[model samples]
Target: MAQDKEFEIVREFEVDATPEEVWTAITEGTGGYLWPMQPPEPRVGGAAAFGSTVTAWDPPHHLTIRSEDVGFPTQSANQLEHTVEPRDGGRAWVRYVHSGIFTDDWDNQYDGASRHTDFYLHTLREYLVHFAPRPVAFATVDGPAASAVPEGLEPAARALGLTAETAVGERVTVRGPHGRPVEAVLDHRDAYFIGLRTDDALVRFFGRGHWGAPLGISVHDFAPDADAKENGAAWQEWLDGAYA
Candidate 1:
């Protein structure tokens, strides 16, 4: 029998950017893209997004952010600790540990968050490489998983009415659910992650398995004129049906 999964998660990423950049990406975010909309106010006990509190803050090194489990998307309060260690060649090793209550949705939430680890770290790299100061936004949605990588990728890409091929730096055009002509170039793709940069947005996808298998998708749209809330709502509804 397989070992049981746990509610706490620990993930690490080797980022090519300097420790400073990685630290900023984890804490403040870049190019108008913030994962949780707002970050902890940088000081211990400072205000943060998601009604979380900053338990510790060590610039360019270590930080701890904790928040109540209520009202969050997962509806679970958790604490995330980030440690950034400098590496040779201006690179850094980024580590993240998230611990919280199980709250019954442990399996679904854990699998989903596990898959998201790849997307999150990958986006951190993209943010460092393409650190645009322009405004950007994020959209996170969850659902049943597929079989494997590219399992549901094709379908989602198909809905976009375009081929779903993993080719970094490749350009592609596809319409969103609203029939908006969205064009983007592939930034990175591996067995676990797909990074796409749209004319005014940065989109990413990860994992491909079942409802509890683990898969994550995020969009970072950079266009001061674009409405992220509307975009997120549209994608949420479209995905609910697409994967249903």
Candidate 2:
């Protein structure tokens, strides 16, 4: 039998929110930033997200959750930990750690996870700074298998009127599913990810084709009447057209 190798990804960053707020954001999820998460119980042995068990818990300070089976043959166990420290001016410093044991295909798995950590943390900062405490309806969809090529993100960028030269803070307008023009600010972009923030929502595109997965899209709509299922279907249809 092959030996299982352990991997860890650690990220440290500063955010504009206080320690309590940052704790809430990481533990409970910020709607537009992360998938809605139920806060774990305040003590060890409580359940956490992703079928994990809480191994450590300290309110507004530290938390650690562990899972025995992560639903992947390549992985045996997974652990996620977060530490928050208060800064001088109501801001907080956060340290996040994701560790796991990989039974196989370690390189690809590690690379993908590390890159995604960057994107997710960036969205967390955005949420803390601009949209904290707002409830949002979330939707996600994936493109067809045909969109799993190296050039897959090209069509999505074009559909959003973006290009290789699109930089952060640039303004652009795109037609929503209902053909309504929506103005958005490009918030983040890189080889495998793109993010746009509008007045009422945060939109993200995942160029997973670069890592052998189909493209993906997610929207966090803060409108009071937002519908996740309906919007997910509409965005899926739009993605179909983009790659058609």
Candidate 3:
């Protein structure tokens, strides 16, 4: 199916945590550390991030939030829905759906949103695994191209400040334009994307255009005691410089 105005992004993920835990994270922590500012309250009629509103709230089973960017009035904004299903051994399966309308130019938006969806879900899993009880600070920054990963991923890894040259289960340190190094490990790296996991955050840096493929960076599970607002601002600044 071609990405069009009616494009709906659907993604599935398996979490090593229980449904109740996942539900609690989504409901109480306002979707669990995905926002730089306050998380949207989960109840219907509650305020949400990006100046959006909550449309649905079903504990541990389903949820939905709707919002729009004033910049594109006709774009219909975004209506995001999440569904959680219980599995054996205290595991859970989660699905995400993003529905929206657009008058024109959806290719880039769809691709970017799709990639972002993946990255955020990965963050969610990380929360369930490491930082479920603690509230968090999350940041995402996007911009123009800097450079592409070389024919191979080593150059890209190096550019990301990764010490390991191989994929999967390797150590990495991604220093954004800010020069502060985020020590992590290579979870996955390819021509299209790079996934790195740290004790406090999960960072996904893009490959094309110097890691500026619209859905740029996704950071989740930073230090719980750290100031969320300040951390978010710092990351945003680093992202801005990295893309510049």
Give the alpha-carbon lDDT of every model: 0.67, 0.86, 0.66
RMSD to the true structure for each prediction, in A, is 5.1, 1.5, 4.7
Task: Look at candidate 2 and give me any clashing residue pairs.
Answer: none
Candidate with the larger TM-score of 1 and 2:
2
lDDT of 2 by residue, 1-244 (tens): 6569999999999998999998877777656697877778778999877788999889899999999989888899999999999999998999999998998878888998899999999988988888877788999999999878777888888877787777898998876665667799999888788899998888898888877999999898887888889989888888898888
- Candidate 2 TM-score versus the reference: 0.95
Off by over 4 Å in 3: 1-4, 28-33, 68-74, 138-156, 163-165, 173-183, 207-221, 224-244
- For all predicted structures, in order, the TM-scores are 0.69, 0.95, 0.72
Off by over 4 Å in 1: 1-6, 30-36, 71-77, 137-154, 162-169, 176-183, 187-194, 205-209, 212-218, 224-244
Runs in model 2 deviating more than 4 A are: 1-3
Model 1 alpha-carbon miss at residue 57, Å: 0.7
Please, what are the lDDT tens digits per residue for candidate 3 over residues 21-59?
887777565435455445568589999766878888888
Best by TM-score: 2
**For model 1, how does the per-residue alpha-carbon lDDT over 1-244 read when each residue is reduced to its tens digit?**
3332337778887867888877767766643343645766878889876678889889989888887755644445678888999988888888888877645555766776776665666666766766544456667665455424446555565555555454677777766656777677777665555567766777776545543344556677766777777777887666655566
Looking at model 1, residue 14 earns an lDDT score of 80
